[model samples]
Target: MSSLAVRRISECFVKPQFSNQICNLTPWDIVMLSTNYIQKGLLFKKPATLIDEHHFIQNLLEKLKHSLSLTLFHFYPLSGRLVTHKTQNPPSYTVSIDCNNSDGARFIHATLDMTIADILSPFDVPPIVQSFFDHHKAVNHDGHTVPLLSIQVTELVDGVFIGCSMNHSVGDGTSYWNFFNTWSQIFQAQSQSENHEYDVPISRQPIHNRWFPHNCSPPISLPFKHHDEFIWRSETPLLRERFFHFSAESIAKLKAKANSESNTTKISAFQSLSALVWRSITRARSPPSDQKTTCRLAANNRSRMKPPVAEEYFGNCVHAVSAETTTGELLENGIGWAAWKLHVAVTDLNDRVVLEFLEGWLDSPFIIQMGRYFDPYSLLIGSSPRFNMYGCEFGMGKAVASRSGYANKFDGKVSSYPGREGGGSIDLEVCLSPQTMSALESDQEFMNAVTEFDPLLF
Candidate 1:
């Protein structure tokens, strides 16, 4: 089979939801940001501040000065760009983290799909800035705009629901895990106990990111159809929902069974489940030819340090774990067998390939060119060992359902989380086109699974 390396990389305005105007500007007129010499963080207040000027954008400098941690976590050098000069155009947008209830759990709920259709040319700073956040990139400003993660809420099955969108660059399944963990920690009101107390535990030393390559080495040319092709987030009128159960106990048993099935050695539950997802997806869509198909999974290397990159290292620090195989071989091997292959693929993550993969990204500005290759985003397998969605406190009631998906320009998205009420396993959310959704629903093997993921479902 052939393969290619991936490189890197919202908001909304709904007036009925709030009395305030969604945007201070009109439809056609570009926001003329103010040319005022604003101070750092002036544009950003706690939770989020308002955009005062019509043409001004808070620069990287000011964001840092205001809240270094938040800024660092929010802005990245590669994907996230800052406006150095002041503008008369209003700040491209504004963010407000609010809470209506006073519960420990909270959600950073937002609705942002207002677009400018087709405003080309970089010189158009106002419209361009507005569109920049268009490709909601997932990166701590990595040069490439990838690995983005955010949640969206929508109406489905006569009910409102949330969908999550994550760019490949911002992180791997683990990065989400890490971020969620931090989210949960904060929600749990355990921020102080976790040492995130306005803290910058620089740990040892800052590692120069110039160590990784943007994409794979030559001869291994980039794979995929095109760069701009993204699985736009979209919604369907017919709400297809289902749910799965994966208690910690069941997961433990599954882990042991998976390890036992492996010929060589031990592997984590992640690898095992990843195998299940990969195999199931492949089985459902058997390729006409035996050409190898790749199930690219991302790997995170945050806590590997003598002193881990602070939980605050809210940047992209992940690599993909490519699990490849042809339909013929997978069908012959069955689920458990194929899973072991995936296990082998990432078992020794601290290996040369993983290291080099990381080093290559930092070694050059290549990430910029590589971020556009991923789509049909799904957390076929993602978890938050640390996040407490139910515990977030935006001064609102705890989020009954901490959703990580959104309804946007894409067909469908997959999000998995611990069942609604408490913790442990996760819930997988789906957002897809009717055709694809129908196909899955009809496929007896994976029928009616939009609501949940049972390893046996596939």
Candidate 2:
């Protein structure tokens, strides 16, 4: 069994150079109040030829904490707390970020008596990985009392893991990756320079202004008075999580097959991959032919907006767009049919559809209830293959593996990540019931498409 030891726990604040600022929560941010925090981590091999392991790890922790403080200066909203306002007469709630409070982000350092192989060798994700992140089951609304962002650095026998837990209300996957990449860039720059300064200019500057349609105002209020009214803190059932890697060649073959079978050129690689997994999981469950199934895709609205919101806008700018069909139709029609359905659903989510959803949301504001939002028969696919997961190099080297926390995870939850090799490859982190996972592993057709990983590669 693996053992973990904690070395330190401290709050790292932004530099005193910037003044206090306030950021109002948009409808995008408000909708995520009840969801779980976004947890992600990267694994790297220890530096070669270390004189003393303890000394090296201590030095690394100091550098990481310093760089994080600098990074928070630009992402000030993350370092702040969520402030809520309530009204008795109307029974409403309003939430915003008070950047002036400056409580700072949480930083943790620890050591684990395990090797990197213990993490990457098993077919199922090791339960020990969950210990790498704090706020295991806490929701975004908890940010009111807890730190808005918490980071943990765990040193393994031969490698290190850096994990982050950020409130979902503050941003989506886009914002999360942006903050991570920027921090890595700053850290890398400081290591290369002699003075160890964090003055390196970031490639992208995040925009804090909340976005809304014309005629719509800020401080959108919810009908509920307290977060407990909608928060879900139920215990999740036992499940199995596994990483499936699809190579560049495998992906191209799937795409070509999907497009050819569907006789349409617009079927995208993402749609194709989604179709494959959707069908595989559905088959594994062995549901009745008449059973209704759904595929919910997380779409970014920055480009879908009419005038196009800035790509660098740093808040939640994503929506869940779904495609539905009967189990019989989804499986009987083949991968092309499923892919086409996903393609149509994604392509149809244009500016007009987005505007109508926003206008309707203004009329009736409600936080997405955790246990009630997703259907048991449905699959929710989050994250994207386009994110630069392997590019977060902090002088040690490129990340050897990418993993997420236990936040917002359900039986049918799936998160897509870019492959470590950096081609057109893709990796999916799939969570499902033990029975369903067992059935999926035995599905010959599905297994044929998966690219097996060798533990030694880590």
The C-alpha TM-scores of every prediction are: 0.49, 0.96
Ten residues in a row with the worst lDDT in model 1? 34-43
Off by over 4 Å in 1: 1-257, 263-265, 305-310, 362-364, 368-387, 394-397, 405-415, 421-423, 430-436, 442-458
Query: What lDDT score belongs to each candidate, Candidate 1 first?
Result: 0.34, 0.86
| Model 2 residue 234 CA deviation in Å | 2.5
Error of 1 at 274 (Å): 2.2
Quote model 2's TM-score.
0.96
Q: Pick the candidate with the highest lDDT.
A: 2
Q: Write the per-residue lDDT of candidate 2 for residues 186-248, one digit (tens) a residue.
A: 888777776654466899888888787786776767777677776767566788999999999
- Give candidate 1's root-mean-square deviation (CA, Å): 15.9
Give one digit per residue, the lDDT tens place, for model 1 in 434-458. Answer: 4554554455533322233322111
